[model samples]
Each structure stands twice: as structure tokens, then as C-alpha cells.
Target: MQIYTVGGAVRDRLLGLSVKDRDHVVVGSTPEAMVALGYRPVGKDFPVFLHPESHEEYALARTERKTAKGYKGFVIHADPEVTLEQDLARRDLTINAIAEAENGQLIDPYHGLADIEARVFRHVSPAFSEDPVRILRVARFAARFTDFTLADETLTLMRQMVEEGEVDALVPERVWQELARGLMEAKPSRMFEVLRACGALQRILPELDQLFGVPQTAKYHPEVDTGLHIMLVIDYAAAQGFSLPIRFAALTHDLGKGTTPKDVLPRHIGHEERSVKLLQQVVKRMRVPNDCKDLGLVVARFHGKVHQVCEMRAATVLTFLQETDALRQPQRFKDFLSACEADARGRTGFEQQELPYFQLLLDILKLVQSVDAGAIAQAQTDPSRIKDAVFAARVHTMEQHYQFPLSQSVTGGSG
Candidate 1:
């Protein structure tokens, strides 16, 4: 049996990129032979074994054919007679289909090496349509390799796949996995762009697609429509290398704008609250983890609350923290600020001016952190009085820096 490095590890190495994980394709091997050689069989749908000494995945080289709908409908055939070239032909992308021999000789049966050098994303074969997951994979690859562009034929095939309704057949788990990967990449805007071009965005994330053509009031958003705003925000967030929850929160923070009445003057007066509910539904449909869903909800719910809190006293900050569960996890306060920054950056002219509120919120957090732990503990006992004391302290600090009155009317007072 001969083992070779394949897929991303090989692709990244060719491009001088840091490879994350190394996967091996074992040719001329069977499950029985692998077990006899002390390899542990682990895969259920297909046969995959773990190296006895290395503990790394070593999948038997195999060929597959589409037997039904979706990605799981594949019929996998693994045999000692299957050539490595045959196995590579079934891969999704040309860049990923390239393999390396055990002696480090690179194999390029489909000219994947040329595509990689050209910084292009190309399908290995017409058989790319067999699995719906490739649609997501290509988008994710775009995100991961920001410098690469999809080949015209590849884009056409992706569009055809979307037109054929193949995207709808994909499971939520697979969709979310690709989405999470894209969000974690250094540049995710290209992912969304590819998705939009292929029409897959509307199928998987209609809430985001709804932003397209949705007009934003020119006075506040002069750059373009709400869709562009959201995309710009995602770009800025990705540029900052924000965490998964933070990046997702930034992307969906304004999703409610699509559902708001167009005739409304402000158009998005109470969108933060509405967005929280909409995001919950979207996350549920995507099958996101509970923690991520909760974080998204919290960021959406209080994303605009910082502006309202800017003029309030120290006690108001304390009450707001307690009511919103922000007090329970102090680090989340910083995360909220990061989300607000992304939101502000996504907005147009007037929206950009509102960044002061985010800065003010950050300043308030620092002020609160400066207070003695004993004082905060004492204030926590009586949640009712917490707002007043917190607001007062905040006002005292602000009076030293600005001309505005230290005290301002507090809304949602019960918190």
C-alpha cells in the first residue's frame, strides 16, 4: 500500500501557505487490510482509518458516484485496484484535487498546480455537480483564499446548480459548517459575493438576501442599499479577525431592516429588538449551537442600547448590565463594543457619525471597571438602586470631559 498527502494540505503547501491539517489517502488498501496492519477503522459512511502510530486520519483511496439527492446520496467504492488518479478526479476543486506522493513528488492530473499558481478556483471535472456540498465549499474556498477568483466556467456551473435547486437539498449542518468556516476566514466578503452571484445566498440565507435592493434613507446611508452596507460590515469585521460569534453578530445585527415598513420615517427605529427575534429564527433554522445563538440574540438586542445609555448616569449602566445579563460575564461587554464598532463601520455617512456612541460605551465600561469590587458588590444587592448609582458615577466622569449635562432621562427604567 502507498500513502500520499492530499487535498488542502497539498494545495496549501504548493501555494506556500501554512497547512492546518495533513490528510493521507491510502491506495491499494482495504478495511480488512488496514485493520490487519493495526490501523483503527473509524468512518461509518465510508471507510477511514487512523494510523497506528500517528493517530492521523488515513482514508482509503476511493471513487464515488451520485446515487440519490444531496451530499449523503453518494455510493462509495473502495478497492485495491482504484488508482490515485481516479480518486483525485472525483474532488470538487482543481486546487484541492492535486496530490503528493510519499516521496514528495506532486501529481497534477487535472492541472490543479497551474490553477493554484494562477490564483484560480476551478472545478476538477463536470462531476462536481454530484455533491451539493461543493457549492458551499467553493464559496468557503473563496473566503479562505481572498486573492483567488472563481473561473468563469466554475461560476456558471455553480449558478446552474442553484438554478437546479440543488442547494435546497443540502442539510443545515453542512451549510452552517461552511458558513462558520467562511466567517472565520481572513476575508469573508468574497464568500457572500460568490453566494449572491450563484443565487445560493437567497436559498440559504434569505434574511440576508432581503437586504438586497432595500433602500436606506439617503440622509443616513448614502453609500448604497442595505445589502451593500451589510457586506461592508462583514468585510470590516473579517478584516479585524473577530471571533465567530462576534462576526456573525456583526453580519446579522441589522437583519430586521428588511422586515420593517418602508413607509416608516426612521425605517429602523426599533430594529434591534426585532432583529433579536429574527436572528433567533435564522439561527434555529441554521442549527447553530445554543451558545452562539444566545450571543447573537444578545448582540442584536442591545446593539443600539449603547446610544441610549450614553447620556445616562452610572446607576443606569449598572442596571442595564444586570438586566441584560452582561454583568454575569464581564468580557461580553467588550464583545458588545466590538459588535457596535462593526455595525457603525457598516453604515453610511450619518451612520458613521454615530460611532461616538460606541466609543462612549467603551469609556463607560472602563469607568465601571475602575470602581472598587466591594462597591459593585454592594450595589448588586439592590438591583433597583443600581441604575441610579451607576448613572451618577458615569455622569461624574463625563462632566470632566464634555459640556453636556451629566444627567439624562433613562428609558426602560425598571432594568
Candidate 2:
């Protein structure tokens, strides 16, 4: 049996990127033979094994046939007769179809090296249309390799797949998985752009897709387009190396703006409430994780209010903090602030501007936490009044802090 390093490991190495994991393809090897040699069986749908020593994944070279709809509808054939070229042909992109021999010889039956050098993404074969997940994968790759462009033929093929209703076949979990990964990439907007170009974005995320042409109030959003603003927000989140929840929040914070009445033109009054409702629909539809969904919900509901924090009264700010559960879950509150900061700095000419509200909120949170809630609760004669007392105490503390010299107290707050 001949083992060769394949797919991403080979592709990243050729591009001078840091390879994180290595996947191997074992040609001319059977499951029985692999077991006899000490490889542990791991794959459920295909012949895959874990190396006894390195614990890396090793799959027997195989060819697959499309047997039904969606990505799961594949018939696999793995035997001693399966060639390395045949296994390579099944990959989604030409750049990922390259393999490396044990002797350090590069195998490029599909001219993957040429495509990699040209910084382009091209389909391996006509079989690329068989898997709907490839559309997400190609879009994600565009986000990761920011400088790379999609080949015209590949884009056409992706568009054809979308038109054929391939993207709609993707499961919710799989769609979320790809979207979450794409959002974490260096330039996540590219992923959405590629999806939009291929018509897949409209199928998977119609709310986000509709935002592209929708105009926003020019004074508030210099970018003017609600969709472009969201893209800028997510890209800023990525550039800041923020966590997944923050990025997701940034992506969904403006969904309500997309549904604004054209009669209202650029104005999006009460879009925050609209955003919260739409975010819930998206969260449920995508089966988004609780952490991401929770954060997205708060950001969507209060992001507009958050942007106006500097002007809010002490009582209003305290109410906002209480409503968001920021006092109890400080980390999530910090993440919420981060998402809002991304939104603020996402506008054109605002990229490098400082967000004083971010640090201001943190300082307010610190001051609120400093309040002796236990003492205030114990002082309350009526148990029902305990929550009100604690809230009042926190608000009182914030009011007192506001009376101090701005620079003498919490670093960024205004008097």
C-alpha cells in the first residue's frame, strides 16, 4: 500500500501557509489490510482510520458516485484498485485536489499547483455539483484566502448549482458550521460576496441578502447600504480577532433595517425591535448555538440604544444593563459591547475612530458591580422590594460616579 499526503495539507504547503493538520490517502489498501497493520477504524460512511502513533486521519483512496440529493447522497467505492488520481478527482476544488507522494514528489493530475499559483479557485470536475456543501466551502475559502479570486467557470458552475436548488438541500447545522467558520476568517465579507455572486446567499440567508441594495440614512451610515454596513461590521469584528459570538452579533445586528418600508426611505425608526424578531427567526432556522443566539439577540435588541449610551440618563443606563443581564453575566456584556463597537467603527471613515462608549460601559459595569446589593437587599423590609432596592442602589452608585470629575474616576465616562 502507498500512502500519500493529500488535500489541504498539500495545498497550504504549496502556498507557504502554516499547515495545521495532515490528512492522508492510502491507495491500494483495504480495510482488512489496514486493520492488520494497526490502523484504528474511525470513519462511518467511508473507509477512514486513525494512525496508531500520530493519531492523524488516514482514509483509503476511494471514488464516489452521486446516488441521491444533498451532500449525503453519495455512494462510495474503496478497494485496492482505486487510483490516487481517482480519489483526488472527488475533491471540491482543483487547488485542494493536489497530493504529495511519500518521496516528496508532488502529484498534480488536475493541475492544482497551477491554480494555486494563479490564486484562483476552480472545480476539480463535473462531480463538484454533486455536493451542496461545496458551495459553502468555496465561499469560506474565499474569506480565508482574501487575495484569491474565483475562476469564472467555477463561479458559473456554483451559480448553476444554486439555480438547481442545491444550496437549499444543505442542513441547518452544516450551514451554521460553514457560516461560523467563514465569519472567523480574515475578510469574512468576501464569503458573503461570493455567496451573493452565486445566488446562494439569497437561499441560505435571505435577510442578509436583501440588505445589499437597501439604503440607510446617510448621516448615520456613510456606507449608505444596510447590507454593506453589516458586511463592514462583520469584517471589523474579524479584524479585531473577536470571538464567534461577537462576530455573529455584528452580522445580525442590522437585520431589522432590511425590512424597513421604502416609503420611510433611509429612516429605520424602531428597526431595533424588528431586528430582534428577525434574529429569532434566523437563530431558530439555522439552529444557532445558545451562546451565539443569546448574544445575537441582545445585540439586535439593544445595539441602537447601546450606540446612544453616552446620552442616556443614569437610570436608563442601569435599566439597560439590568435588561441585558449584564450585571450577572459580565463576560457576555463585554462581548455585547464589542459587537456594538464593531458596529460603530464599521462605517466609512469611522474605521480607526475610537469607541469611548466601549470603555465607558465597562467602567459603568465595574461601578455597578461595586454596589453592595446584598446590603441593599438585607435593608429592604419587604422581600418583593429587594430587587428594586438593589437596582436603585446600583443606579444611585452610577449617579454618584457621574458627579465625579470625569478623568478622576472611571477613565472614559462623561459628566
Candidate 3:
């Protein structure tokens, strides 16, 4: 049997990127023969084996035939007769269809290297439309390779797939998995752009889709379009090396603006609460993680105050931290601040400045958290009064230590 390194390892190496993992395809090998040679069979639908020493995967040369609908509706045929060309031809993108021989010789029957050089994301064959997951995969590739452009024909095929209801058949888990991965990529906005261009985003994430034509107050958001502002926010978060939860918060922080009343054009009075409500629906529908869902909801609810934190009184600041559960989740609280900074800088001319109040707000959270709440609790006679005493004490400490902007003030220390 001849083993050849294939897929991402080959593609990444060709792009001069550090290869993360190596996948191999074993040609002219049977499952029984592989088992006899110390390779353990592990594949569920096709013949895939693990190396005896390295434990790396070595899938046999296989061909897939579309049997039904969705990503899993595939019939796999693996045998000694299957050629490497056949296996490579079934892949989605041209750059991912290249393989490398054991002797370091390249086996490129699909001109993947040329496509890589051209920074083009071209499909290997029409089979790409057979798997609905390819739509997500292409979007993910657009996010990862920020410089690459999708081939017009490939985009046309994707649009046709969406029109044919292929994207609708994608399972929720797979959709979320791909979307989350895309969000963490270098330029995540490209993923949404590709999805929107293909008409799949409106089908899958209608809340986010509705943001495109929505307007925002130009004085606050020079970008003017709420959707464009959020995309800029996501890119800024990515540029800042923020975590996935932070990026997700940037993406969903303004969902309510999409539903603003026509009479309130360019003004979103209670969009914060509306954003939180929409965030809850998305969290349930996407099966988002508790941490991501919780953070997105909090950021959506309080991002306006977070942007204008300099105007908040000590009690309002304390309430903001408390509502976000910052005392218990200090790290996520930091992430929340980072995402808010992304929002502040996402505007057209504001990109040059460090977010207006990062260090200032950070000092407040740190100081309030440093307060001895247990002592305040012990000083209280009534148990129910303890919580209120501690909060008052924290607020008092903030009031004494920091100076807040008086241009505007938020009343009621509850969000």
C-alpha cells in the first residue's frame, strides 16, 4: 500500500502556513489488510485506520456517491481499486484537493497549486453542491483566507444550492459548528458576506440578515448602517486577538436595531432590551454554549451603557457589573469589556482611538471587586439586608474614588 499525505496538511503547507495536522490516504489497501498490518479500523461510514505508532488517521482511497439529502446522505465505496485522483476529485475546493506522495513528490491532478497561487477558492467538481455543508465550508474558507476570492462559478453554484433548499437540509449542530468556527477565523465578516451572497444566511440566521438595510444615527455610528457597524466590530475583535465569546458578542450585540420602528428611524430607544430578547431566541435556535449565550445576552442588553460608561454614576456602574455577574465571572467580564471596545471603535472615524474608557472602567470593576463584601455582610444585622449593604458599600467606594462624566446619567441601578 502507498500512503500519501493529503487534504489540509498539503493545502496549508502550499500556502506557506504552519501545518497543524497531517491526514493520509492509503491507496491500494483493504480494511482486512490494514488490520493485519497493525492499523486499527476506526471509520464509521468508510474505511479509515489509525497508524500503529503515531496513531494518526489513514483513510483508504475512497469515492463518495450522493445517496439522499444533507451532508450525511452519502454512500462511500473504498477498495484497493480506488485511485488517488478519484478521492481528490470528490473534495470541495481546489486548494484542498492536492496531495503529497511519500517521497515528497506532489500529486496534483486538480491544479490546486495554481489556484493557491491565484488566491482563488475554486471547486474541484460539481459534486461540491451535493453536500450542503460545502456552503458553510466555503464561507469558512473565505473567513480563514482573508485575501482569497471565491470563484464566480463557485458562488453561482452555492446560490443555486441555496435556491434548491440544500442549505435548509443542514443539521443545526453542523450549522452552528461551522458558523462558530467561521466567527473565530481571521476575517469573520467574509463568512457572513459569502453566506448572505449565497442567500443562505437569510434562511439560517434571519435576525442577523435583517440588519443589512437598517439605519443608525450617524452622529454615534458614522458607519450609518447597523449591519456594517457590527461587521466592523467583529473584525476589530478579531484584530485585537479576542476570544470566540468576545467575537460572538460583537456579532450579535445589536440585533434589536434591525427591528426598530419605522417612526423611530435612526433612533433605537429600547433596542438594548429588544436585542437581549432576540439574542435569547438565537441562543436556543443555534444551541449556542451557555457561556457564549450568556455573554451575548448581557452585551446585547447593556452595550449602550457600556459605551457611555463614563457617564454612569458609581451605583449604575456597580449595577452594571452586578447584572453582568462580573464579580463571579471576572474573565468573562473582561471579555465583555473587550467586545464593547470593539463596538466603540467600529465606527468610521473612531477606528484610530483606543476605546474611550477601557482602563477607566477596568479600574472600577477591579476596585469594586476588591471591596470586602463579607465584612459588610457581617456588619449587617438582618440577613436579607446584607446583600443591599454590600452593594451600597461598593457604590460608596466607587463614588469616593472615581470622577464620572455628568453630560448624561443613567438612573435606577438595575438593568
Candidate 4:
């Protein structure tokens, strides 16, 4: 059987990027022949095998046909007769449909190398419209290769897919899967931008989509569009190399701004709490993981207070940490702070502003958490009073370090 490296391995190699995993397409092999040759069969729908030595994935040349609705409705055809060119034609992007022979010869059946050199994200064939997931895939690839521009034809097909309601048939898990991957990319805003351009964002993430036209206080947010601010925050999280939870928190932190009443104009008085409520709706609908959901919830509800904490009394600072369960989950508390910092730096002309609140808040939290709450809990004679005693200790400890005037402390609180 003749085998050739295909898909991402070839695409990334051509792009001069580090290829993490290699997938091979065996043009002349069957499930039984592959197994007999020492490869292990793992395919459920089509012939896929694990290499006996490297353990990398190797799939027989295959083609898929649309059967019904959504991504799951597909018929796969894989056999020894299928050509590598035919298999490559079925790929989503032109940049990914290229293949490489074992002799290091590049195969450009669909001009993937040319598109890669041109930094264009183009579909391999007209059949790109057959799969709705390709829209999300293209958006994610945009985020991955931040310098690449999407082909106009590809975008037109995506918009048509959305118009045909093909995007609506996507299941929540697959949507979340793509979204989470996109959020962690080097530049996440492009993912949202592409989705919005295709009209999929309005259907998939309306909470964020509504923020595009929403105005914000120009004095505070020079990038006065609430949607743009959120995108910037998410990009900042990515730039900081923060984890998925932190990035997720940044994305959903300002959902309330989208829902603010028109009469309120640019000022979002209770947007923090409003953001938390909207975030809940998104997490539930998207079935986001609990770790991400929990932090997003905390950041949504308390980000404003956290931003302004340096101005508030130490007692209130202690109460804020207690309310967020920061004392119990220090790591998550740290993530919450990181998300807030991303927000603070995401605005226009504010990225390099020497904001002292971040450092001050960290120092305050350290001092408050240093109090021997365990010892204080042990000293309490009444079991029910243990929580009260620990709370009192943290508040008392915070009072020692944060004795500044509330008005002075509130400086640089707006994010």
C-alpha cells in the first residue's frame, strides 16, 4: 500500500509551522489488510488504524457524502481503490487538502501551497457547503493563522450556509468545542468576527452579537463599542497566554452591556450583575464545562467590584473574596484576577496605563489570606461560629494593610 502524509501535517509543514501530529492517507489499503500488516483497527465508521510503531493515526483514502441534516448526517466511502487526490478533494480548506509523498514531494492537487503562500483560507471544493461545521472550522483556522485572510468565495458559501439554516442544525457540544478552541487561539477576535460576518454569531452567540451596535462610555472605553471591547479583552487573555478558563471568563464578562437599557445610554450601572445572569444563560445553553462556567460566573458578577476594590474598605474586600470562595479556591481566585486584568488592559490607549490596582489588589489578597483562618476556626468553641470567626479574622487582617481613603482607593477602577 502507498501511503502519503496529508491534511494538517502537510499544511503546517508548507506554512513552516511546527507539525504536532501527522496523519497519513493510505491510498491502497483495506481494514483487513491494514490489520494484517500490524496496524490496529480503530475505525467505527471508516477505516482508520493506529500505526504499530509510532501510534499515529492512518486512515484509508475516503470520501463522504451528505445524507440528511447537521454534521452527523453523512455517508462515508473508504476502500483500497480510493485515490489520494479524491480523498484530498473532500477536505474543508484548500490549505489543508495538500498532501506530501514519502519521498518529500509536495502534491498540489487543489493549489493548497499557493493559497498557503498567499495566506488565503479557501475551500477545497463546492462541497464545502455540505458540512455546517466547516464554518466553525474556517473561523477557528482564521484564529490560528492570524495573518491569513479568508477567500471571498469561502465567506459567501458560509453566509449562504447560515442563510440556509444549516448552521442552526449544529449541536451545542460541537459549537462549544469549536468556540473553546477558537478562544485559545493566538488571536481570538477573528473567530468572532468571521462568525459575525457569516451571521452565525447571531445564531450561536447572540449575547455577544447584540453588543456590536451597543455603545459604551467613550471616556472610559475609547474603543466605545461594547462588542469590540469584549473582543479586545479576549485577545488580551490570549496574548497573556492565559488558560481556557481565564479566556472564557474574559469573553463573557461584559454580556450585561449588551442588555443595558437605551435610556441608560453609555453608563452600565448594574451591568456586573446583569452580566452574571446572561453568562448563566450562555453556559447552560452551550453546556460549557463547570470549571469555565464557575469562573465566568464569578468574574461576570464581581469584576466591577473587584476593579473598584482598591477604593473600598478592607472589610468589603474581605467580604468580596469570601463571597467568591477565593479563600477555598486560590487558583480560581487568581484566574478571576487575570481575567479582570485583561479587561483593564484591553481598552484603547489604556494598555500601557500604569494601573496600580492590580498590584494593590494582589497585595491586599495576600495579606488577607495570610491570616491563620485555620487557627481562628480551631479557636472557635461553637461549631457554627467557625465560619464567622474566620471571616472576622480575614476582615481584621485586611484592615491592617488597606487603611487608605475609599475615594482615593477607587482611582483607576473603571475597566
Candidate 5:
């Protein structure tokens, strides 16, 4: 049997990046031979084994053909004669099709090393159209590799695939896996642009695509359109190296604007609430972790709250915090501030006079940091006094800084 390192391990090693996991493909090896050699059979649908000593996965050389629809519709043929080149031809991207022999020789029939040096991403073969998931992978690669551009032929192939209704073959889980990886990249905004250009975003997230060219009242938004604003926010968020959930929060923070009335001055009076609902639906569909979904919802809901708290009383602020769980953890509050700041900074057209209001909100959130619900809940002091003091301080700070009419800001009569 001839064993060779394949896929990401070989690609990453060539890129001078540290390889985390290594996958081996065994050519001319039968399942029975593997079993006899003490390898443990672990794969269900295909002939794969775990190395007895290293515990790494080793799959027998196999060829596949599309037998039905979607990624799982492939019919795999595992035999002892499948050549290494034959196996490489079925990979999604050229860069991932290269292989490293046991003696450290690189095999690149697709000229993957040339593409890598030129910062280009190309499909391994026309067969890339078979599995629609490859489109998402291409977008993810674009997001991760800042300098890479898709070749014209590859772009044409992707467009043709989209036109042929291949996107419908994708499952939500696979879509989210690629999307999550893109969001976690160093420059996630690139992912959106690539997806948009490739027609993937329109199929998977039409709501997001609707943001393109939508006018925001120039007085508040100097940026050209909502889509550009969203991209800027995502870029800024990624530059800060925020967590995946927070980055998602920044990416989707303004999603509600697409559904709001275009004629209105702000055109987004209750968009935060709408965005929360939209995020819930999306997160549920994508099967995201519950904690991440909750975090995303909270960030989207309160993204605009800071700007409206000018005249709020301490009691009102405390009550709001209690209800929203914003102060449930230090990290959550920090994420809230980051989301708000990214939203504020992403817009280009607001009058310079409005900067103070944004600064005021930031200052107030920072000033009340020690007395937030999380702290109050952990403190051993008297509950009633602690709540009363925090509430009063919040109100007094708002009045001193913003001159906001407390009576109008708070729901109940201000004490």
C-alpha cells in the first residue's frame, strides 16, 4: 500500500502554516488488508481506518460520482487500483488537491503550488459543480486568504452552477459551517463580497442581499448604502479580533433596516427588535449553539439602546439591564459596547454634532460598569439599597451628562 498526506495538511505545509491535523490516503490498500494490519475500522459509509499508533484517520483511495442530489448523493468506489492523481482530481479546490508522498515529494497535477504563489483560487475540475457546498468553501477561502482572487473561468463555473439550481442542494448545516468559518476569519467582510459576487448570498441570505443599494437617509448615514455599511461594520469588527458570536452580531446588527419603510427619516425606528427576531430565525435554522444564539439576539436587540438612554433614570437602566440580561456577564457587556461602537462608527453621514451623544452613551455605560446587574447579584450587600443606589446613580448621571428629561425617559414617574 502507498500512503500519502493529502488535503489541508499538505496545502498548509506548503503555505508555511502550522499543520494541526494530518489526513492520509492509502492507495492500493483494501479494507481487509487494513484490518489485518491492525487498523481500526471507524468510517460508516466509506472504507477508512484509524492508525493503530498515531490514531490519525486513513481513508482508502476512492472515486466518487454524483448519484442523486446534494453533497451526500455521491456514490463512492473504493478499490486497490485507484491512482493518487485520480483521487486528487475530485478535490474541490486546486490548492487542496496537492499531495505529499511518504518520502516528502509533492504531487501537484493541477499546478496548485502555482495558484498559491499567484494568490489565485481555482476549481480542481469542472466536476466542482456536483457539490454545491464548494461555493461556500470558495467564499471561505476568499475570506481567509486576503490576497487571493478567483480565476475568471472558476467564477464562470460558479455562476453557471448557481444558474443550474445547485444551491438548493445545500443543507443548512453545511451552509452554516462555512459561514461560521468565514465569520471567524481575520477579514470576514471579504467573504460577503465574494459570496455576493458568486450569487451564493442571494440564494442563502436574500435578506442580507436586500441590503445592497438600499438608501439610508443621507443626514444620518453618509455611506452609499446599507450593504456597504454592513461590510464596513464587519470589517471593523474583525479588525478588533472579536469573538465569532460578537462578529456575527456586528454583521447582522442592521439587518432590520432592509424591512423597514424606506420613506421614514431614520427608516429604522424599531429595527433592533426586528433584527432580534430575524437573528433568532436564522440562528435556529443554522442550528447554532444556544449560547451563541442568545448572545447574538442580545447584541442585535440592544445595539441601539445605548443611544436612547440619554434621559433614563438609574432605576430604568437597572430594570432594562435586568430584563435584557446585558450585565449577566462582563464579557456580554463588553460585547454590547463593541457592537454599539462598531455600528456608530460604520456610518459616514451623521452630523459631527451627533458625536457627543454617542460618546455620552459610551461614557454612561462605562461609568455604571461596577454597579451592573452581574455585580449586584454577586455582591453580599443589602439587595434593596444596592438596587436603589444603582438606579439613582444611573438617573443622576444621565441628567448631569445629557440633560435628558427623566420624566419622559423613564416608564414610571421619576422619584
Candidate 6:
């Protein structure tokens, strides 16, 4: 059996990128032979093994046939007769099809090297359409390799796959997986843009797709288009090297604007409430993780309030903190603040502007966290008044910091 390093490791190495992990394709190898040689069987759908020494994955060179719908509907054939070229031919993109031999000889049967040099994303074959996940993969690759443009033919094929209903076959988990990865890329807007171009965005995320032509208040969002604003927000999140939750929050924070009445025009009055309602649908439909879903929902419902923090009274700010559970989940609260900062900086010509409220919120959360809610609870004479007393003390702490009037009632609302 001959083993060759393949896929992203080889492609990244050739492109002068740092290779994180290496995968190998074993040609002319059978499952029995691989086991005899000390490889541990791990693959459920086909013949894949883990090397005894390196623990790296070594999949037997195989060919696949589409037997049903979706990504998992494939019949695999792995045997001693399967060739390396056949395996490479089935890859999603040409650049990822190239392999490196044991002796360091580069295999370029698919002209992957040429495509890499030209910075193009070309599909390996028409078989690329068999797996609907390839569309998400291609879009994700666009986000990763920001400079690489999709080949005209490849884009056309992707569009065809969407039109044929292949994109709709994708499972919710896989959709969320690819989308989460794409959001973490350097220029995540490209992923959405590619999806939009192929009409897959409308199929998978119509709530977001509808935002493209929807206008926002140009005075606040110079970008004007709600869709463009979201793109800018996510890219800014990525630029800040923020976590996936923050990026996801940035992506969905403005969904309410897409549903705004045309009669209202640019004013998205009460869009935050609308955004929270729409976000719940997305979170449930995509089966989004709790961490991401929680953060997205918080941002969708309160990002506007976060942006208005500087002008808010101490009581309002205190209410915001309590409502977001900042005292209990400080890290999530920090993430929430970061996402709000991304939204503030996403506007056209506002990319480099400093957001004073970001630090203000953090500082306020920190100050309120110093309030000993546990101790106050222990001192409360009555059980029913415990919650109210703790809240009043916390509000008092905030009011002291901001120097609000001492005469303001404990239940006084922000005026």
C-alpha cells in the first residue's frame, strides 16, 4: 500500500500557510490489510483508520456513489483496486484534491496546483453536486481564502445545485456547523455573498436574505442596506478576533429590520422586539447551540439598548445588567458587549470609531458584581423582600457610582 498526504494539509503547505493537521489517503489498501498493519478502524461509513504511531487519520482511497438525498446518502467503495486519482477526483475543490507523496513528490492530476497559483476555487468534477454540503464548504472556503475567486463554471454548478433543490436537503446540524465555521473566517461576508449569489442563502436563511434590499436609518447606518450592515458587522467581529458566539450575534442582530413595514421606511421602530422574535425561529430551526443561541438572542433583543448605554440613566443601565444576567455569566456579558461594539463599528465610515459604551458597560458590570447579593440575601428579614432588597442595593450601588439623586424611589424607572 502507498500512502500520500492529502487535502488541506498539502494545499495549505503549498500556499505557504501553516498546516495544523495532516490527513493521508492510502491507495491500494484493504480494510483487512490496514488492520493487519496496526491501523485502528474508526470510519463508520467507509474504510478509515487511525495510524498507530501518529494517531492521524488515514482513509483508504475510495470512490463514492450518490444513493439518496443529502450529504450522508452515499455508497462508498474502498478496496485494493481503488486508486489515489479516483479518490482525489471526488474532492469538492481542485485545490484540496492535490496530494503529497511519502517521498515529498507533489501529485497534481487535477491541476490543483495551477488553480492554487491562480487563486481560483474550481470544482473537481460534476460529482461535486452529489453532496449538498459542498455548497456550504465552497462558501466557507471563499471566506477563508479571501483572495480566491470562485471559477465561473463552479459558481454556475453551485447555482444549478441550489435550483435543483440539493441545498434544501442539508440537515440543520450540518448547516449550523458550516455556518459557525464560516462566521469565524477572516472575511465572513464572502461566505454569505457566495451563498446569496447561488440563491442558497434564500433557501437556508431567508430571514437574512430578505435584508439585502431592506433599507435602514442611513443617519445611524450609513451603509443603508440592512444586509450590507450585517455583513459589515460580522466582518468587524472577525477582525476583532472575537469568538463564534459574538460573530453569530453580529450576524442575526438585525433580522427584525428585514420585516419592517415599508410604510415606516427607514425607521425600524421597535425592531429589537421584532428581532428577538425572528431570532428564536432561526435558533430553533438551525438547532443552534445554547451558548450561541443565548448570545444571539440577547444581542438581538438589546443591542440597541447597549448602543444607547452612554445616554442611559444608572437605573436603566442597572436594569440592562440585571436583565442580561451579567452578574452570573460575566463572560457571556462580555461577549454580548463585544458584539454590540461590532454593531456600532459596522456602519459605513464608522469602522475605526471608538465606542465609549463598551468600556462603560464592562465597568458598570464589574462595579455591580462587587455588590454582595449573597450577603444581602442572608440579612433580609423576610423571604419575599429578599429579591427586592438585593435589587435595591445593587441599584443603590449603581446610583452612587453615577451620582443619581438619593430621593429617587427604589422602584423608580429611568426617566
lDDT of each: 0.79, 0.89, 0.88, 0.88, 0.78, 0.89
lDDT of 4 at 269: 89
Alpha carbon deviation, residue 397, candidate 1 (Å): 10
- What TM-score do all the candidates reach, one by one? 0.86, 0.96, 0.95, 0.96, 0.84, 0.95
Candidate 6 yields a Cα-based lDDT of 0.89
Error of 6 at 46 (Å): 0.6
Residue 241 in model 2: lDDT: 98
- Candidate 2 lDDT over 101-160, as tens digits, reads 999999999998899989999999999999999999999999999989999999999999
lDDT of 5 by residue, 81-161 (tens): 999999999999899999999999999999999998988999999889899889888888888888899999998998888
Q: After best superposition, candidate 2 residue 351: deviation in angstroms?
A: 1.0
Q: Candidate 2 regions off by >4 Å?
A: 404-415
Give the root-mean-square deviation of each candidate in angstroms: 4.6, 2.8, 2.8, 1.7, 5.6, 3.7
Query: What's the CA error at residue 203 for candidate 1, in Å?
Result: 0.9
lDDT of 1 by residue, 23-67 (tens): 999999889999999999999988898889989899999999889
lDDT of 1: 0.79
TM-score of 1: 0.86
lDDT against true structure, model 3: 0.88
Off by over 4 Å in 3: 354-356, 404-415
Residue 381's C-alpha lDDT in candidate 4? 88
Cα shift from native, residue 48, model 1 (Å): 1.3
